[model samples]
Target: MGEWRRCCDNAVCGDNAVCWKSDGVKLKLQGENIQPANENEDLKKGCYNYGVDIADAIVPEWKELWVQVEPEAECIWFGEQEASKKPNGWWSFTFRNYLGKSVIRIKLADGREVVTDPIEVVSPKTPLDEQCDPLFYPKFLRTLIDDLIRYLVSLPFDWEAPTEFATEERTQPPSPIFVLHVLAQHADTICYALQTIWRNPHRRLVTEERWVLLSEASSVDADTILMMLHYPEHLRPYRGNSLSTLAQRLKSKVPERVFERRVTETLDTPENRFIKRFMDIVLYWCDELKRLGYWEKAKSHQPKLEDLQNFVRFLRADPLFADVSELTIFPASSQVLQKRDGYRECLQIYRLLHIARAPIFDRLQDAIDNRRIDQLYEFWCFFRLAETLAAVLGDGQRPYFSTLESDEGGLRRDLSANLGNGYQLVYNEQFEPIWKPKARKKLSYSVPLRPDISLLQENRLLVVFDAKFRFDEKDIQPNQPLEDEMDKAQQEGEIERLAKHADICKMHTYRDALKCRASVILFPGTKGAFHCTNGTKKDNPCLLDIVQNNGLKGVGAVPFVPKPEK
Candidate 1:
């Protein structure tokens, strides 16, 4: 203290501040205005540091704030974290809002966690340029992270490459790899992200690669992916939220570094060795269940009917599954595991062998014993054929019914309509109606709206569903990343669009189509926009926004944009 101050030299303040201590001191903050150089273990002695009183700092805009997070768990694309016993006293990560984030969490050993801090960023620099901002941390960067992570955490398996269904003719096999390209810029990125996770009619008809991209972007891991493949049938198709909200939640993962089966030979040759090897791995896991007396467990307690139903429904949750747990062909009472959700039952039996001493590898072998269906999700694959069967049976009931690529209207059409047209179609030059139909029966004219795509055949209703597409300049690809302003605007606009479509259709068209009764605009919705319309006012805009959050699983809509060029 004597030399630090140095005031004792001349009993006066030093001319140069250099006379102060050479090393910086730790400043303890006390209260709002006091800051002390040191603390003697007494709370009251600490000094108080006054924070800056900058303009508009109290309620700073979140858009200007960048999230600063430490490195999180990473996984290779389409890979998976091996399921293992979690540590005691530790709870598993809840994937509630993490739909868009990666699923295969490769957690730290213990006592490790992720923390998000805030970093101030100038709004001007937040934008993107055409030159592809190389190191940009775009707002939708999180989406890429989510997709990447999901793919990394979830493990995967594949069946015969070209499938053995058409083995007689050895021909070119479709490329198994699917890549989804999005405009390099941020503005369109958000909309593209939503399109991925949001379920659209005939989503399957879209090329497999596009679907996988969206699913991958949504942090849907391989396991969840398998479950999606085995989803149960429903009377109505899902139509609630627009595809955008679901996209923002996912993170991108590193691409797969290894390939499972790189095949060049024709399909008719001996069964692919890689597929056989994969089958072996699956079967090996099943063998252990048999050894544990799972086979001996009496079917007396479990009815064949209930078991089949349960199996189909069990794997509906996208986060779980494989093929049916077994590979056996069954009577309707005991159909092929591959024909339904039998894989769930197969995994259920594995709980019998979790003992510390029994090796996990041995359990795997048990699944493949005697080239059986085994205790894995192989049975889940049977679902893809449900639509074909439904057409044959014509019970007017099928396990699945879906649209194809042709189902989605052309991208050009959406661009023309949204960028230009309104509700009028004037083609009077051709052989038009000789005379306008008389203002017959009813004296009412209402604005037309969207139609009902979720109808069941039993309803005897023929509702027309016309989709509209919207294009944004933000979708252009760049060598570097660009800003995502358009995405924000689109999200806001989409909510309004869905409500407008629904309201006008329900009130006008469907009601006017004689006894048509129900007309709805099944459009895409944002995450928070898919709210319920309580007994509220008739004129509320974005009706879905008025009530509690349900979901956009069953909404109808307009046209679909094209695959991103980027």
Candidate 2:
């Protein structure tokens, strides 16, 4: 809404690079239904909001970006590649727009990079406030992550199995480094669990017997020495003469006594040592967070850096831990840590951390930083579909996995969860031309086809769903005018902007090629409609109705918007 101005404070430049000019490249956002940049009041000073939909902003397509660079700059870089300067002192490029924030950088020949303000691209379906509000997107994502961790823990997963890092695959759950971000997000919970256990930490009485000189001994346990001397007379012969000889030697020269000490409520128990190890891990994570720039990103949320440091400091300064040595090994046999109140809670946190450490749970920071909402939305839909099927149908066995590589050199993962009554839900399972197994009864006649979601009954493909992060208003709005009302040029222009037809064709391709009963399009919209075989439908059917009643007999689209439950 306001005139574009240079805001140098918000922009970040390389430490070694000179801050020559912050706003070296001027950007003009050109499109229809463009909202005011300041709609997200919390937006940074140099950031601008660009809307994609001319009318309906559901799906994103390439958009024009006109840039004017300062004449002094020898080179300009949009992202990693250098931009080609035009003859008119301007540069133009088409950006594949999506809902998230991205920055533009201009690198000078003098090794100085001029980082400009970020650009916040908003999808037509996304509300500006929800996209920018920390409480909305960030909190919702955290909740989803928490739910995922809970679900993963409940299943009998092979947590220690070897798994490779997440490549550029859209289907891999997450990267291993994302575990650090998950910890950062739940840092507050970690602190609370730590503090609670530290106050009333598990302790056990330790009893020990030490041999000391008679003059130095405070209290002697004669029974302990007497017990050693009282071994059965017949059994002593087999034990050996060395024990008897040593006992007699001890009595004559050194005259030592056995001093038995009973120390009560000692904090040096295995459980307490386990707690100390957890603290050490957390301390190490704090340093990792700083190194990865996670601490800076997490400043807006709870359990601040100072809070975490103080919690560690408080634990270390306590005298109770003075005798507790560093944990050399995990106390796998300790039942107290697994079942006790405060200790059990800490163990649960540790389990979550352990589960998160696997090189899965895909690009979460990108979702948080608005680097890629499309991928994030796809993941959300995958989980949502799985949850919906499991709840509607009955719960089945734990998930099974299959892996393959995409033609694009990315890993393609297929994870399937069983739903009772013979239904199975799968994510990113490919329908290939040559399939020895895993495809069950269905196979693609041509190239491989991978849908975002697939529902199978008795190992037979029944229905497929493809998640699209975009939507056109023409498909969702009610009481639309006839196409004849618009001129030929106007209709052509509208056709060029909307993607509903192309999406429908893709669904048709999946349904026909895979020989599935139905295919559906899942998008972030407010309405869902079904187009059935029996053309007698009076109105559109609800998404649930299609899944439960219609048996997914037809192709259609549904609104699967990401909103937190009340």
Candidate 3:
């Protein structure tokens, strides 16, 4: 014990405390945490040391209290009992309400700091089989981002730069937006295509048997002279007083005579022009990625961007393109780009670039790189719901409104679509109308609550939905009688437990206050079709009943996940 204490002299200590070294920290998952028995053991430790859904709370267990964490996170805190030293004198903290990927540095009181591995916080209802494999979360995140991009692109809205006569609110602004993610996604294919084109570029025969002065000739040869026979004008220059004299002079002066050459050139071909145009686009994106501060936020993507830039630089300076003119016209319809080996890959690159230039995708990489899985899920749900409603309710005639506004808090986006059949879908907009409310008109009467989505039929509120990235069966389960002991246990002031049922309770508020036909909670989970009659204490099994009877009453939860189309 004496030797151990002497060796641990550098460890952090409290008043009269025994010197201790932290034996590493472990996260204890609580509150609807999913634990699969067959979870892969290989993922037990590393960058992703522990996995928890956004809804789950994790308690961090460490050996000492003097060991602090740097950049204190808002989501972590200590409960009353946890704040005080335990019977064994161990201090603790909990990751109560947090989402996204994050890491912390443990700063011991002894002035030593150690950075921990990354922790992944994903959506509770993520459709991927994360219970047994946490690695699936990244793949799921990518798929969700793609769906969001597709959704935004599908909106029937055109962007125009705001002019002096147009107000910023009324006129959409044109901004120079580059889609770096698209280039990164197709980086491999673009590099390979450039290489193939460099090795075997299409060449065209520019000139046929053109004569050049002997002094300017690279080398004199018999073929060079023989080719000049096709051009009799050149023979005229060497003609003498007699044919024999001319022939003798031609033979003797063959080494000094004018040379005729047939030229095959690579520059100025359709294939080379197409490559030049592609290089310009790639280089533009590479420059934009750095200028827009994207590289600083996510350093991992920097290497790929650099590689793409360097390869384009090499292609531009290649000997084959030494005389290639700048691209004034793109050979978009040329057969060389569509059929040739190396140039064919450029076609694929063009397709990817088209997808990458989607509207509102400029901010997508920020969400992805920051590991904002919850926001990604919300975007996917918003678009999926809109598409589903359009399909079921008939295609939209025109957008009721669409706006993307920027302020000190960043961009604020709202979209509304008129579904032709007297149905309209609105996103992230206020409930009240611009004008005075009519009798029986559905609008927020008290504090305005803007649900994520609202459906209106013939200018009357039909229903409202809020996309929730979290769900726990325990919170939605029917209330059951509890014994005295259990009842007392519930009263111990568990704040997390108290808020678990807040989402469903808020749904009731939306139904009652907004006076909508139905208020539904859309979440990514298996808890489907949890139906209940509005203002009823008893649980009802039918939402169709409320809708069919033309009653202003229905509340429930619906499960939603954006699956790929068949």
Candidate 4:
């Protein structure tokens, strides 16, 4: 008899898949058991010459795959395409301290390989933590532009395609403007992503400075700038990752066209022209003020050149002004220029922008960026989901809405189910027009997950919006105590009951679950700041944390007071 033997009784069955290692024999034959030939086999191929199958790798999808391991097992290296690297394989099954079964996932992939399950051994179980940031990153935010260029330039897609930008060298001085020319079909995605980022409570987008003002419009306020500069860490999933809401919106509400009608043409009535002209005046004044400041006594100390360049580019392209007012560089008479004031001096710059792009003001400028891209994406997901949302909701513009008896009107159907974060989950798009009156009557929910708000947008997409409100100890009205400790403990029973609703919406995962759309939460606002929520699944993470605006129709804020440069 050899030193190792088969621990499991072969007498049990023929060519079975179970192999216990206490026999200390792997790949080696023991005793007179007479097992199959070629005891040692290539693990990756999943079979030994003797039909002994070992599933070493698996295709790691949403439903996690696992491999079992004994306290001491053979080297099961988990590398993607090739067995070149070892992440946990190096530890060599000595992970008892990690727990009884330690499960690790193969993140990326190799097509032919399945990150399958049940290796010859199973370790302890460990909770996997998400590693990436939930917020929209600059690189990711710019991906559409970069990816679009790559996609277009590489039309052939094969090796014959161009490897560099098509604009390289051919276009002189590289147009300062970043133009993304995509198929109109895909235009919604760009706008959708923009709105998503803008609505992210954690995001602070990069935008132009609108210092000019028409009589009706004032200089872009500090609150507006601040709104553009912030984004959230995570956001709820909406319309099942489709920006159709945005697309549908653009279809009927072409912002650019709307702005043109509202700003340029007297569609130009007396009130409008007065309003527009006043903006003209304000713009001229702002420009003059900036230009004056450029040469101000303090100019010697700061980065005025960079500031000047920004101001120049802004005035030239600002959507606020419809024409290059003769006031800016033309050095208009005192009547037009008025007393050279503060930022009001730059008002003349408004004239230049108006003449060039009056018709497409909203195109270059967003309502969210009307110094804000937003219908509010945070708790709701997708700032102005627009047409896509309508499409998702199908024809039912007002779908059903569901909430908990304990909760009131905001988005979070039941806030506690979502991890401390108030927003999470996205539902199907078919449940419309109205939700079952929050009675004990179970509506359409077939799954174990219940979203925050279940309603309809555009009548096609079943919409869900969960609201998250974060209040600091300081911000709570002066009367409320920060910690109502005694009440919280007692409230647990009620909170748990509230959380059971999570099960209500989970059953909607029909064969075609893709249609089972939803948005987890709707953020009204938080601490007078922004709000955000991460989606239920890992794949569709929030674009960013802080939604770009203050849960308003667009992302804007009214500063209580203004201070020069804190």
Clashes by residue pair, model 3: none
Per-residue CA lDDT of candidate 1, range 1-566, in tens? 10122123333323211122212221110111111112111211211111111111111111211111122222111013232233332122111101111212223334342211111111121122212332121322222222222221121212112432211211322111110100111113222322322232011111122233232343445654443434322112333356434323322122221112222322211112222222333343224323433322222322432333233233233332122233233221323222223222332222112212212123223322211111111111112112222333234443321111111321111000000111111100011122325321221234322231222233232222222111111111222322233344356653323333334334334435423323223222221112112322222123222111232222222211111113
Clashes of 4: 151
Which TM-score value belongs to model 4? 0.18
Lowest summed lDDT over 10 consecutive residues: which window, candidate 3?
Answer: 1-10
Ranking by TM-score: 2, 3, 1, 4
Looking at model 1, residue 557 earns an lDDT score of 28
lDDT of 2 by residue, 254-346 (tens): 233444454456888788888888777777776765675445444344345558767877787688788998888878667888777677766
* Model 3, global lDDT: 0.53
Residue 524 lDDT in model 2? 65
Model 3: runs farther than 4 Å from truth? Answer: 1-93, 105-117, 122-143, 149-157, 160-279, 282-363, 396-401, 404-412, 432-442, 480-490, 530-552, 564-566
Q: Could you tell which candidate, 1 or 4, scores higher by TM-score?
A: 1
Those runs of model 4 whose alpha carbons end farther than 4 Å from true positions after fitting are 1-381, 384-458, 467-488, 491-566
User: What lDDT does model 1 reach?
Assistant: 0.23
Which candidate leads the pack in lDDT? 2
Clashes of each: 89, 11, 0, 151
